[model samples]
Target: MTALKRRGTFAYFLVLVTMLLVWPMGVILMWAYTPWSKSVKVAITICLTILTVLTVHSVCYFRIMPS
Candidate 1:
């Protein structure tokens, strides 16, 4: 008898929660612990990087502009 491996919902939930609480650590956890494929991980990393860059750029631009 062969038993299939299943990742629990709690683990996924934890990842999401951790991401909300501490993004950098959560990203590290996602890479280190999760069984997700490399392509998925790379896609997520790219998305996060783009989002971070956009957010910082927007904040900086807004802060510098006159009212």
Candidate 2:
């Protein structure tokens, strides 16, 4: 594979792994390093934001009270 292809593959894996494990950094990396268009990035950003909001709301709404 060409150097550019290898770099792109590496960036892809890095973004995927980081998105699962450490997502704030992953967003930055996706915007800065990946070849995705602005619209795709914006869509993913919106989805991630919505997911985060839902997760936070679920946790806050479902917390157990101490006896």
Candidate 3:
């Protein structure tokens, strides 16, 4: 069982935006301190995982041509 804290709405939103836009490592690190719920944390992890995979896919497929 994990101990949860009481962080306000702003912190919650910050974590969310951090999860979406910031580096995935940052979000993963924040999970230890942030007071967001388990579900929210899970959602963040899922979203980051999906986005990272997509990002990797895009990078792999991207073609650079000198014109």
Each model's TM-score, in the order given? 0.80, 0.88, 0.55
lDDT of 2 by residue, 32-56 (tens): 9988999999998889889999999
Clashing pairs in 1: none
**What lDDT is obtained when candidate 3 is compared to the true structure?**
0.68
Query: Candidate 3 — which residues are off by over 4 angstroms?
Result: 1-22, 64-67
- Which candidate's TM-score is highest? 2
Candidate 1's displacement at residue 51, Å, is: 0.4
Better of 1 and 3 by TM-score: 1
CA lDDT, every prediction? 0.81, 0.89, 0.68
- C-alpha lDDT (0 to 100) for residue 49 of candidate 1: 79
Q: Judged by lDDT relative to the true structure, which candidate is superior, 2 or 3?
A: 2
Candidates by TM-score, descending order:
2, 1, 3
The numbered model that scores best in lDDT is: 2
TM-score computed on alpha carbons, candidate 3 = 0.55
Model 1, position 25, has a per-residue lDDT of 76
